[model samples]
Target: MSDNLAIRKIIHIDMDAFYASVEQRDNPELKGKPVAVGGSRSRGVVAAASYEARKFGIRSAMPSVTAFRKCPDIIFVKPRFEVYKEVSQIIRNIFFEYTDLVEPLSLDEAYLDVTNNKIGLPSATLIAEEIRKKIFDSTALTCSAGISINKFLAKTASDINKPNGMKLIKPEEAMAFIETLKVKDFFGVGKVTAEKMKRMGIHTGLDLKNKSLGFMTKNFGKSGSFYYNISRGIDDRPVNPNRIRKSVSIENTYDNDLSDISHIETELEKLSESLETRLAKNKIQGKTINIKIKYADFEQVTRSKTSQYWLSKSTDYQPLWKEILLDERLVQKPIRLLGLGLSNLNTEEKENQGLQLTLEF
Candidate 1:
C-alpha cells in the first residue's frame, strides 16, 4: 500500500429507505407507520420498506404476504417510479455542483470523487456533510454518507451509521478498520460467497488477508484478485461517471408452473416484447440473445446464442427463442419463471473519455 495510492477522496451517498421515504414524505398520513412500497396482491413483492416497517423484519424483495404476516398492520403502497426518478435527478444536479466525477449506482445511491472539487474544498468529510444537507433541503429527505480514500471503503463505511448519518475512514485507518470488519460486510461478498468463505475458515477481513493470492484465486476465480487487493486497503479503480449498460433483461415469475409448451411459448412472446421495448427505450442493440428458465423445483439454467448481426427488435430475437427452446433440457420440468435478455451490446466496447484530477491535502 503506497501513500500515493491513497490520495483520492471518495464519498458514497445513499438515501435512507428511498422509495418508502418518498411515499411517506408526500403523504403525511403514512408517516411513522409501517409502510411497504409495493403491491399487496397474491404475487406482489415489496420494493422498499420504511424504517417503521423494517422493525417487523420487512425488507425489499420480500413477499408482500410475508410482510403482512410479520406486521399485520403493515401498509402496502404502489411504487411511483417517475417521482423517484425526478428526485434522483435533483440529487445528481447537487453532486455536479461539486464535481463532475459522480457515478450513480442507482436512483438512491452514488459514488462521488471530490478529491479535486469545483469549490476547491480540502476536506472530503465537509463535502459529504454539505451534500447530505443539500439533499435534505431539496427533497425533504435524509441520507447517509461515507467518506474515505476510495470507493470500496466509502461504500462500506456509509452503512455504519445509516439513516441520515455520515462516517469517515482516514487513509491511515483504512487497513485497521477493514481488518476488523466481517467478511459478510464486505461490499461485494453476497450470502453464498460469505458462506463459502466461512466454510474455508475465512470469516473476517484479517482471515481473508492471511490467505495467499494463489489460494484466493484458486477458490474464488477472477474475484479472488479483487478480494486480495481490498483486504490490504488497495483499490485503484477510478470513479467511472459514464458507466455503460452491459445488458438489458426482463424476467417474469408466474403464480403457477407452466408444463404446456404452448403456454410457455406464449409467455416467451410476452417476454420478448418487453425486452424489445426496453432495448428501444435505451437505444441498445446486441449480438447475443439469452433465455433463462427457472423450474418449479428451483433448478435454473440459461441458454444463449450469438449472431454476427446486431438484434434489437422482438421479431429479430423471437426466432432465436424457438431455436433455444428446442433443447431437451428445457421441457424436462415445468418452468416457474422465464427471462429474456440481450448482451454483447453495441456500446459494450465503447469507452468514455474521463477527466483526471488530483488533490493535495
Candidate 2:
C-alpha cells in the first residue's frame, strides 16, 4: 500500500462458534449437530452455539429451555471457562507475533493493527489468511477475518464472511461499500441510535451521508460528527490496542483567559461535542459525571455527579448537563481549563435467570 496518507491496516478476527467449536473438537458425535455450550435445560443460559444451532435460531444467552424449543435435538454442553481461556491465550499470542496492536473485544474476537507489524508483511489480507490457517492448525477451529482501513470498517467486514472466511475493504472502495450499508450495521450505532436516526430518515450510510453534519450534531450531540465522517468512509481513527475508555472527558485550553459567562458556554459546547464522540464509540455507560476547572492562577477543582442509569450515550447527558451547568458555584469560576469526564462503572445483574429455570434456547 502507498504511504501517501498513512492509512491504518486494521483486521478484526473472530473465532467461529468459539465455545461450541471447542466442545465439538473433542467430541466426535457433536460435530454435525446443533450444539450449545452452557447449562442444560431447567437452568442457565447458552454461552455459545454452533452454526447448526444458529440455523435453528438457538443463540447465545438464550435460556437453555428456549434453545430446546428452538431445536429439540439441540445438544447442550457445560461451559469450561478454563479451557476457553487457554485457547484464547493461544490465539492471542499468535496475534502478538504479527502486531502488538491487538485489542481483544472478547475471547472470540479481537482487532489488530498491522500498519507496523513484527513480520513486515506486505498485505493485511495475507496476514489475516495466515492467522486463520495458524488458528485452525493449532486448535482445529475456524475463524473469520476482516481487513480494512479503520477499526469500525474492519469490525463490520469481519461479520460479512463467517466460518473460516475473510473480507478486505480497500481505501479506494470504502466509500462505495459504505453507501450500501444499513445504519444499524455501522459499528457503535446501537438500536437506540439507529431508531433515532431512522426517525430522521437516516436508514443507510448513503442517507446519513446526505444529511448535514450540523443537523446530525444537533440531534445526536458529539457522535453526530463521527457518524457523518464514517458514513462517507472518511474515518481517520487509528486501530487502538486499548479501545475501552477508562474515562470519557472533554477539555479545552482557551486561547484567552475566560471570565465571561458566555465564554464558558462556548468552550463547553466544543467540549461537549468532543466528549460525546468518545462516549458513544466505546458504548460505556458511565455513572459519574465529573467537571474540572483550572483557573488562570493554576488552581483546579473538580465536581462530580453520581447517576442511577449508565450514561448510554451523549443524549443521556441532557439531564445531567442541565443540572451541572446550572450550578451556581461552577458557573461563577473564571475557567481556564474546562473538562468533563464520565466514570464510576456500575453494572446491573440480569433479573431473569436466562437458563437456570428453562431448557429453552
Ten-residue region with minimum lDDT total, candidate 1: 348-357
Q: Write the per-residue lDDT of candidate 1 for residues 245-309, one digit (tens) a residue.
A: 78889887788788999999999999999998899899999999999887777678999998888
Candidate 1 structure lDDT: 0.89
lDDT, model 1, position 243: 81
Q: Estimate the TM-score of every prediction.
A: 0.90, 0.66
Best by lDDT: 1
Which residue ranges in model 1 land beyond 4 Å of their true spot?
4-6, 252-260, 293-301, 327-337, 349-361
Best by TM-score: 1
Candidate 2 per-residue lDDT, tens place, 93-190, comes to 99999988788888989988787679987688899999999999999999999998877789899989887789998877788889999999898899
Minimum summed lDDT over a 10-residue window in model 2 is located at: 352-361
Candidate 2 versus truth, CA RMSD in Å, comes to: 17.5
Cα-based lDDT for every prediction: 0.89, 0.79
